[model samples]
Target: MADSLRRIDSGEASDDYLRGGGTGAVWRPPPAKRGALLQEALVRRPGSCIRRLAQGDRARQMQFSRFLHNGAVTVTEMAETAAARTAVVVAGRDVLAIQDSSELVFGGKEARARGFGPIGRGGNLGGLLLHSVLAVDAVTGALFGLVDVKVHNRRGGKVAARRARSTADKESQRWLDGMFSASRVLHEAARITVVADRESDIYEEFARRPANVHLLTRIAQDRRIEAAVDGSTMLFAFSDRLPEQARFVVTIPAAPGRRERAAELALRYSTVAVRKPKNGAAPDLPNSIVLTLVDVTETSVPEQGEPIHWRLITTHTVDSPAKARMMLDFYRRRWIIEDYFRTLKTAGFDIEAAEIQDPDAMVRLVAAVAVTGVTVLQLVRARDGTTDQLLRDAFDPADQPLLETISATLEGKTQRQKNPHPKGTLAYAAWVIARLGAWDGYYGKPGPKVMRIGLQEFHSIKYGFQLGLRDV
Candidate 1:
């Protein structure tokens, strides 16, 4: 067993390592390179290992490299691809999915070349937009992975002279194309449900999505739908069947490029049925479910607000009032994606400031970064009690010394000082892990305001210690 461990740790393992050499024989090697062996073991462990493993996927790397060199692919396509892959690997089929887009503004100069629209009044301080998909474990509220990312154009009003006659740039089409492609990928994985805001209710988006995949999307005030019982045409509106305590509020993040605030609402039971348009082809939609529309407004700081009334359309079935309420609860999970985007840009990956010139390279890099974030979260969640036996089981026995070093460092820190924020308490270990994963975000004095201790950081610290163990 020791010999096989040595061979694997040294990158010298061969097919013969698995072959039986002798009966009741236990191959052992002299104790040496213990630190190096431990470091290798730490790298091999799952849950924060994606960042390193990403360097080894030749096919994915090659595809990204080609796209980067060509400058033809858009960030949205890459994000969509990453989201689709994540959905398959992490969320599978039984999860309720939330998808949304947020704007980030790079500088006007960066936007000019990237074809991003100009910053509207009060938008992010010159940043690009990012749209992302978040999957929450239905029972645990744990973040699974990012399904997609869309970087909006910063120069929306500018038009190049050569393409002045065109309606839109080819880059814009990539968002739609990527969405279509991601939908296919989701369909291939499992029977899953999707929830989105009204922006996703466009004809192409709904029409192109796979039939089996369920969607719950907010409706525009101008959207037309018919009453299932009355057969009368009208704009979709929330039914008056909500609980008296329903409320709504908006949220605005202090991050750059997000000048606008988002609305969050809490509503009660309402009926929704498809109303076919008078002149257009009827949408191929399944049975509709009535739901209470809750619009949580965007705000920089949490505050109180009035509940705004709205309506939504969904493909899910809400046969009972309780089921209808549950659907609304599911929709609230959409905020998880927003939190994820903030974490990626401000805390974990910092995708916006990345200098990779090739769009493909940017995509590959973002994918790797996003996956690394998820991996860190997974590792932090896996730790049990003070020992973290799960990590020990996955790591090679030779890597113990490095792990002990990390444990000692953490042991010295006060529990109150680990995660000062109330929301980040569950993710205190994430901060340490991020350090192990090679995250450099918290290097400066006192860390940034947006920098909360998180799982990614924990993964980094833990992995770094493991690497040290392997080298010892």
Candidate 2:
């Protein structure tokens, strides 16, 4: 492992994507020296603190700390690198860019010291607000990676009313910003579909959507429709009146207070012209925009559970039952972003536990974790072989040989102990890493924590392997 650091320090292993120059206030990628350090820090244990990432080397720990606190290492540069990597995988493929926001609460005193803003409903909490977009293969549901990320805290004290504020001055603007960000990053993709939850159902989100990019979001408000079509009926009531087209069963994942249960959902679809509100923020948008609504309602509800219902609004063509199902599947991909937040928070990185009090350093840490969190998700997504991702998705081309050797050494003579997935696939690499993390392959699937540990071990071994080659 020491040998790898030496190589990086000498600029022998600097990332090609990070080599560039910048002018003005824009944060360009660091020079080869810092670029090498940045790459090493990112590939370290995902979600680990600086001390752990430094592996008890006191000098390395200080260097890691300096890297985070450095003024040149900005979130903008980190996001650029993430986008460049995502563009490679999504090229020529239809992709879904899932956008969502999450709050990281660090307490009232911590907030005041760290310069964080209020985050809860009552405005009593102090934390940072993170909105990000994760790209996925539309057809296969394979994880592509993060396309864009925005991290900012609200103003210390807010005194503006909803009607008084423009979309640029409001937090809700992140939804529109995410769309623009994804479009810029995914220009290489054959098709781009942006998916979000109800909070993203803004007039501008639908109006300002980039050409060739589709939008899908759950209905948030009981918005009014154009009166010419059906006597000024509202969206919800109009949806309820639509005839059911099909019924399907789905297993709903368990949440904080909600138990997992099988839901029988009746699907309905219709085209409606959504009328712009009298006080709509964006006056430049058309008075009405035609959109397809796919309504899903639970036919049978469990005794202790609320009935599942989702009125999905989309720009996708949903004239047929098959197309409606496809939209639902795309909307379902929104959960991937939610899972990513969990991985960054309590599940994998435990980012909230970091003791960095400086606001800038904390922001940089979040940016680094934002990229690392996706790596953990990639491993979890690949563990089941459902995602047809290649080893290159999560690892470098040079690392493939090391993974192959590790897989062979970990396998036993018994077929049950062998890696079942095909070689050069992310699933096969995941199996090898799981075994390295002490997982019994037959027990169950390897989760984010297992993948995190396995990744740490792999990096350590990879460095030692590089050292041996240099010695030879």
Candidate 3:
């Protein structure tokens, strides 16, 4: 590692990207050398292990592993830096702190690894649960970055036993941890709406949010209402009685055993006092709190299956139909993080499939690669008429020229097959790489998976390109 980085000082350095440049201004790792090595190792290869990134050099791979094990470089510091960078991205926009958790499955010689917890089907697998919060501009709907990520292991116990514990002590804490972290880091944003699914519907989470930070989560708790609008009715019953105010159409993505389809949904909303739950009570929560409840149900039943239904609770005022619709839109963006997890686990980074046995190293690798995962998503998402900003906004200065040189070479049969977005824009670069990764060189846009494979290939090209320059 020292030998490679030393080239930088002697004008022998090909470039920082080649030198491993994932370490950015947000992090402040001690003995800056570790920071440099990490950047080089991560950037040189999007998701490859130390051995692969180090060109199959076993000793070098051990050095890379040792660097992660060093006490000087802490995971909190790395995560904090990532949060700081995300804060900068969330500066002025009304953003959605989209949070969700996914379980990572790993295998080894033993089912129960020392550092890992029971995982997978029947708890026979070993792995970690990654709960992450990604920031998205609420108004413009642009991807910012990941503001918070909480990785933890589930302890061996009956599901009922785990649920009986305190919310703060259980896995549910990840929701609060994500919300508070976003509020603290992106505090300057116009408004931060913490968005998540039903799993995030915790009473403690609602009671704990800071001012200017609202939560938009699907309601799971059916707490009794103190003052029903018509009678002593529960949440769903009260919501059911409200007249449908608006009708809209929503597109549902394809899932296992389900085909992608569009459905016409009827929106029902009501202003109600959300009563406290009888079970797992929190001291700070009032007996009942005023909140806007919005329900979007597929009034039109689909041909084959259940229609889409989302019961949402929010602190944001949703008195008007437009506001209600906008809130639903915000909730919909929660899927962006879900797509992000796919990118991490599938083609791009494959952090879940990582074979590293050491828990700390695995954490370090995931944390470092997560930054790139965010960037890859940004590149792909920005193609949807979001920004005309140049590729320099996302790619390194050194990578631009190489990308440009290859862009024309990767073009399709006609001009339409080539990238039409502004030159140097992130979308243009994405187009070129997508072409390199076997996208139909024409106008059919590439998805996250295609973009990731392009990036992985681009890194190899860039790595060899930089090494070749060293000969000069």
Kindly state the number of residue pairs that clash in model 1: 84
Better of 1 and 3 by TM-score: 3
Per-residue C-alpha lDDT of model 2 across residues 77-191, encoded as one tens digit per residue: 6677677678777889999989999998878765766687778777677778888899988887788888888788777755678888888878899899889988988899999
Please report, as a residue range, the 10-residue window in candidate 1 with the lowest summed lDDT: 18-27
Give the candidate number with the greatest lDDT.
2
Query: Between prediction 1 and prediction 3, which has the larger lDDT?
Result: 3
Per-residue CA lDDT of model 3 for 1-472, tens digit only, reads 2334233222232223122111122212222354445654554466646667666877667667766665445445455656665676566778898999887877733636556787667777777777788888887667777687666766676565654677877778888888888888789898889999999988778877788789999988776665534645688877777899999888887765888788898998888777677777666677777788999989777766787888999998988899999989999888788888887887477777666777766766666666567767776777655744345445665567888888877766777766677776677777777776678755477777777677767877876886899988
- After superposing candidate 1 on the true structure, give the runs of residues whose Cα lies further than 4 Å from its correct spot: 1-93, 109-129, 150-183, 186-191, 203-209, 228-230, 236-271, 277-303, 308-310, 354-405, 412-472
Put the candidates in TM-score order, highest first.
Answer: 2, 3, 1
Q: What is the C-alpha RMSD of each candidate to the true structure, in Å?
A: 11.3, 5.3, 5.1
Model 2 per-residue lDDT at 471:
100
The TM-scores of all predictions, comma-separated, are 0.56, 0.91, 0.87
Error of 3 at 456 (Å): 2.6
Give the Cα error of residue 247 in candidate 3, in Å: 0.7
